[model samples]
Target: MDLGLRDATVVVAGGGRGMGLAAARCFADEGARIAVFARTRTDLDKAVDDLHGRGSPDAVGIVVDVRDATQVERAFAELADRWGGLNVLVNAVGPDVRGTVESLTDDQWRTAFDDGVLGIVHTVRSALPLLRRADWARIVNFSASSTQRQTVSLAAYTAAKAAVTSISKNLSLQLAPDEILVNVVSPGSVASDSLLAWARSVGVDSEDPYALMAAITEHFGHPAHLPRVGLPEEVGPVVAFLGSRRNSYMTGANVNVDGGTDFT
Candidate 1:
């Protein structure tokens, strides 16, 4: 499918690596003008170069920490100036803040909320004007499946993602008049670099994400429907489609990309 994304301007938050990078590559493959935002200059540049090689030669990377509203605003300004306008804003940035509620401190809980919820808010607010300029605009935010399912040791993280889902639902109604759609993609057991790093840290040396998921399930007592875990590429195109012109009449919906796992 064309997805009608050719020449469309898109800014992906946390596109430096992992699932964000995967989504950016998918968009660029559909011929979108991509600009990736991240804190690390090296990762951002590398992702941009990879996107160009995939198809979007004009793909660029911007260094900006979404936690800092000022930096996000400036980065969006630069993106709008370069592209003339924006169509899709995908906030795929979220740090892993995992711990049992009783074990988590106030600062730890705050970090989870800040990364999962406030970061998306900052990006969406900063890009609203640019998105409004387009004939149709889309916002795709990330929420973990644990928000709906039970994932032990991730109480704070799940809580924060639940907030993201709520924000997307509300924004969908508020932005409907502008023809801007806001939706959430709740993923489970994605094989992202972040997830892999966590797995390795826990002494799981396997390359497969399902291995990580298995370890998680065994340790946390949460069962997955699928026998295996999903890869970044598995979730990337789904996000690209949601943020593309191809997706019409779907907003404020929390679409689960969790391999048919429904612990509810």
Candidate 2:
């Protein structure tokens, strides 16, 4: 339960909101030194304060768009100067592009790849040196459950997430020699604020998270065995554990944090 994360240096690329912030909270509660990256300065400031309140000895929030390699590099440079090394890198950024393959435009596809795939690439590329300098290193990248399950109208999003999963697998193998464990966390529909807004936009006005998920399953066709959608808080501990020093041998694996899915 300790997770061996006290004083560990961690970078959460999308740690300003939703699931990313939730995962960062887990590390914060474990007393880690956390650096959170996100574009919105307000959200980053709020997250840093919250992390500090949650027990992080040191927490800094950086305003950086992961889609821009230069911004990402600069963010990591600052992290390097402050922490000297990184023990864990958690990439929680993902594009929200969703549509049928035919309905999605070329620009939308490019946006998906740029935000979901290249964003991760930028962070990982910039963080490698810092990770390598640490005594123990881990990378936990976010992927979507739709990638492993049969889902509808998520071609672009799924494609981008699939690339993230593949990249993590490859990184796991390549970094094995350095003892840097890499893994993926695939989450099903969670009742985040955006998801709640989406549900309301579609007239699925249900306050209950489980009932809301039922409506989503009935309308949107993404079903899980648990009947209810997972929560941001629910996914956080799994990510924290995977990125912790205790997770020594689990690498190149996609851990689905969905309520329950048949795929794996």
Candidate 3:
């Protein structure tokens, strides 16, 4: 279970909080050197501190919006200068807009695409060169289970993530010669700050976020097999595994970490 990640250079997008932070911590625990990217300086700093405190060989936070290609490129360059080369790139950044096609505005659609799809495109493009230089590389994208089982109000989000899955599959073929594995991890119902805030925004009572989430999940999220919601930590280890040298043959695969929530 070594994962062979010790001292590896890892870049985690949207690593400031939630599942991204969880993934960063998991990598750090395995002795990886981490460079976390997010837009907020405060959150980025705190995440880096937390990672270092958790036993990362080295940890740095770069403030960069993944939606901005220039910023992403520069951040990757900085990471390369600091860590020498990249071995893992986790696309944990995502947009939060949710609604059906009729309820969503054009701007919302564009924003969703920008945050979910284009953000991955920009980050992968920026990091491809460094990844190519590495003896082994992995790209783990955070897609969603909703892409497999369509949600009623998550039209735009699902569409965007579906695009991410498609892109990862295509890139897997292109990066095969380089031995760079590209794959998607579709998580369901992870209790993150973002998900809690989103629940509150959608009229869930702040005092009982879990109650609200449980009610919703019981009705919509537990159709597959496991009758429960997943946790950030539960999803993080899988991502770390996918990014590790241990994962030699798996690529272009959409692995569901959804507590069996999509089996309907």
Candidate 4:
């Protein structure tokens, strides 16, 4: 299907790795101008090269932490100055905080909000002007199904994602008049290096990421309808479609890309 994404300028915040990079790859394959943002210079550079290889000749990567408003602004400004405007902003930036309610400290909660909630706010705030420059604009924020599911040991992470969902809903209302669409995509257990690391951090031990995810989800009582955990490539195309012109008239909605695991 033609997504109408050719030449559309897009920013995948935290696109250096995992689903972010996967989403960027999908966009690049659709012939979009891709700009990825993340803190690690090495991952960002490598991702840019991979995108270029995937047919986005103009793909570039920026090193910026979304929690830093100044860095976020500078990154978007640079993209606008170079690309002449922006079309879509995929907020693939996320935070992974693993702790039970009683075990999680105040500082961990603060970090969760800072990285998950404020991260989205900061990038959106900085990219608004550039997005406005386009005739049509869309914003896709990454959220987790953990927020909608009944789970234990991931309270802090889910709390932060809940805020992201709420913020995107409210922001959509304000941006609608301008014809700017804002939506959130919530994913369940997806296989990626980040997911593996997160699982390990929370005390799930496995050499294989997918195995770890299965164990975690089974223990939490939310399992994918599909046989196994998902892949970044699986989630990427859905995001590309939503961010594309093909997805008009859908705003303020939270779309689940989680293998039928979540009702929300």
Best TM-score among the predictions, by candidate number: 2
Candidate maximizing lDDT: 2
Q: What is the lDDT of residue 135 in candidate 3?
A: 83
Worst 10 residues of 4 by lDDT: 205-214
Clash pairs for candidate 1: none
Ranking by TM-score: 2, 1, 4, 3
lDDT of 4 by residue, 169-264 (tens): 998999999999999989888876766776777777646645665786667767778756778889998898889999999999998887776384
Please list all clashing residue pairs in model 2, or write none if there are none: none
lDDT of 3 by residue, 13-121 (tens): 9999889999999999999989999999999989988997887847988999999999998998887787677999999988898888999999999999999999999
Give RMSD (Å) of candidate 3 vs. truth.
2.1
- Residue-level lDDT for 78 in candidate 2: 90
What's model 1's overall lDDT?
A: 0.87
Error of 4 at 173 (Å): 0.9
Q: Is candidate 3 or candidate 4 better by lDDT?
A: 4
Poorest lDDT segment (10 consecutive residues) of candidate 3: 221-230
Q: Rate the local accuracy (lDDT) of all candidates.
A: 0.87, 0.91, 0.87, 0.88
Residue-level lDDT of model 1, residues 1-264, one tens digit each, is 789999889899988888899999999999899999999999988998899897799998888989999998899888877877799999998868878989999999999888888999999998999999888899999988888776668899899999999999999999998889999888888777767777888898659666777887777666567767788888899899999999998999898887777544
